[model samples]
Target: TLADAIFRHLDHGAAAGPSLAGRHALVTAGPTHEPIDPVRYLANRSSGRQGYAIAAALAARGARVTLVSGPVDLPPPPGIDVRRVETATQMLAACRAALPCDIAVCTAAVADWHVANPTDRKMKKAPGATAPVLTLAPNPDILAHLAAAGPARPALVVGFAAETHDLERYAAAKRVAKGCDWIVANDVRPETGIMGGAENEIVLISADGSERWPRLTKEAVAQRLAQRIAEYFSPDRSPA
Candidate 1:
């Protein structure tokens, strides 16, 4: 990026994490936009605060960050390269283009389906129009794709579960099916208000077991998650 080029004359570089130095990290953010017409799109209530915070935390910990993001109104974090995309397919392409990263954080609330054939022209309602039918197709699961990247897979692939209920059980099932190294599960029920809120609570599920964390600020969540990632990759890291 032109902004990153400003520090071209840098030496070894001053960074926060020594262990994660020289590692490449990829993070996807926001909801996928499945277009129904030229003007309308399908998406979710994701402010991208959580994903952005995670990316910033990882970058601060010395990893080269590539944020593959969907359309959102938030500002990109500093010292990180941003790849803007609208749909899940575009986001997947961006991730593929920047493959073999050391870590991948699948944080984007990607849509599971898209309009099978979206009209290029603006869809109009006739004078007595009732409703328009849209055929839907499944969007590629970005997390599953990254986890099964085969040769170019990241060392650590983490997936997120935004379920309305049975968070742990559902997340575990997704973890096994998606092939991710870890799964961060959260309950997004109406009462949780975690969809587009400032605070979050989650449980990290891995091969060893599950670790529960209390509700905290988004920044605090990022910091704690980053620390867990650091420890997991540490030479002497151990399961808690």
Candidate 2:
């Protein structure tokens, strides 16, 4: 009920102000599960709260949003299309399929590596037996792929960087490496409580510069980001 109320209030505010009507947005969220076997997988602590909030905010502003999410406990936001996924590969495929969108926000905590040869059957354990070794392979760089999508690339591509140290340095490097328009950087160290917590302290990095944002609820962050997106598309506004 609290989330519903928040969404309603934000939606009402967005509807009364700048709108993203006739625009399409693609958002990716949650932690991808890299399977090692039929019953076991690797994942992170992402709760998908921020990504879902962003999707809702964009939808509230009248953008047609397609949310490609990994496993998350939260429900899908209202009035937006949702595509559920598991592995990083699947998430990338789903994102590619939602192409030609005007905006792209990738917030998924996609695993950097996946099991090179996953087994279909559940792995079994035996007493006095050596544990099975897993070989890892690099996962696709979804943000980079989308950024280099040529004619199909979204006009505004945003990516998230969850780091435990050197937030600004790593995020700025990522922006160049991924070729995305912007990078939303946040410290996700355990004490920060951002990995699975409601509040976020972030730095919005772009070609112009970085803006430090105060700690706020994920919903508030989403609303602010949505407003920025709307401004970017506004005819009177200059590109940042």
Candidate 3:
């Protein structure tokens, strides 16, 4: 498949050299499932394609990649460690457990809130009764926590901002707010075909400025990001 071929190319260093050798990378992907009831939950349209591609790209570049993923239908990529998770809390814990990494990329669309008191039994509908109200509580901020991890923080921390408008403006602010080194901002509006589609058009926002990338397949985006990450850690390479 295209994904396999992309990884092979990177593995061989046909484009750029394997600059990530001897490094460790952590990636989070997919959408967290916030259960509303025993049989119902809230989730987004994340397909985990981009995050999976990134994990593959890093692994191909000889990085020891640990992917912490939420519930998704995609198969695990070869040559990397995978930790499956369900809710935002689990994802946060999984990410922290994979810490002391050189790089961290959080691509999971985590739910901001979860049912405060979810019951194990199935919630039944009562005849002539009104719907039940759910008490929501905010989930932990995984990206921020990692970024603020002090000495244990990764050298480079990347976060994703899936927005529908003000892409550049909002992403720039997110970079500062989250204390991440970079923000991969993309339009997730249905028409953009980015939420669950293969291709993506993104703006790479860093401390310096934002660079608009051309529309490309998720694999291409991953490869490009991996190369940039390699350059960031390359000796004699200046800070961006």
Candidate 4:
């Protein structure tokens, strides 16, 4: 009953105004794993909390939510459809398959590079203690691909910028480079704990400029982002 009530309120809040009812929202979450060997892999520290919460929020607001996640432990949200993938290539393929949505949120911290070819069997270490060399190749940029996917591109394409320095400067450049409608930028420094922590601070970057958001829990950020997406998709809303 509680979940039902909250959903009802969200529906009313979105629909009473210019809402995203009947629109499809696609979200990517977690970190893609690149296999090195049968027993070893490469990945980041993404928890997928923010992205999953955003999917839940969009679902609450009456959007058809499609979550393409990469090995998250959390269960799928109440009213969202989820597709799981392990590698960056798989994630891109899934996004292509789920194209033409009203919005696409690229929240996954996909690896920039992956092993050219993973060994089928476990790699044995040398008795002399010399480390084995691994060759890496760049992975496809899923967010950039979605934004430039011709007519199938969503009305609003959003990307996440996890940066270490020059926060807004790099974020703005990333937004322009990715060709997305918005980029949610964050500093993942040690104290802030943006990677694996529950709380986060983000700045919204768009064509006009940037807006620094207050520190909040992951759930709150999702709700706020969902609301902004709803407004942005409305017939009367502008980039402003």
CA lDDT scores, all candidates in order: 0.86, 0.92, 0.90, 0.89
lDDT of 2 by residue, 1-240 (tens): 999999987757465557899999999999999998888999888999999999999998889999999999999887889999999999999998998899999999999999999999888899989988889999999999999858998999999999999999999999999999999999998998888998999999999999999999999999989889988998876555
Query: Please, what are the lDDT tens digits per residue for candidate 3 over residues 122-217?
Result: 999999999898899999999999999589999999999999888888899999999999999999988887888989999998988889999999
What lDDT does model 3 reach? 0.90
- The clash count of every prediction, one per candidate, is 0, 0, 0, 0
- Local distance difference test, candidate 4: 0.89
lDDT of 4 by residue, 27-64 (tens): 99999999999889999879999999889888877899
User: What tens-digit string does per-residue lDDT give for candidate 1 at 1-240?
Assistant: 865665652322333343566889999988889998889988876888899998888876777899999988889898899999999899999999988798999899999999998988999889998888888899998999999948888999999999997889999999999999999998889798888899999999998889999999887788777777776677888663
TM-scores for every candidate against the unseen true structure: 0.91, 0.93, 0.93, 0.92
Candidate 4: minimum summed lDDT over ten consecutive residues — where?
10-19
- Backbone clashes in candidate 4 total 0
Task: Output the better candidate (3/4) by TM-score.
Answer: 3
| Top lDDT hit | 2
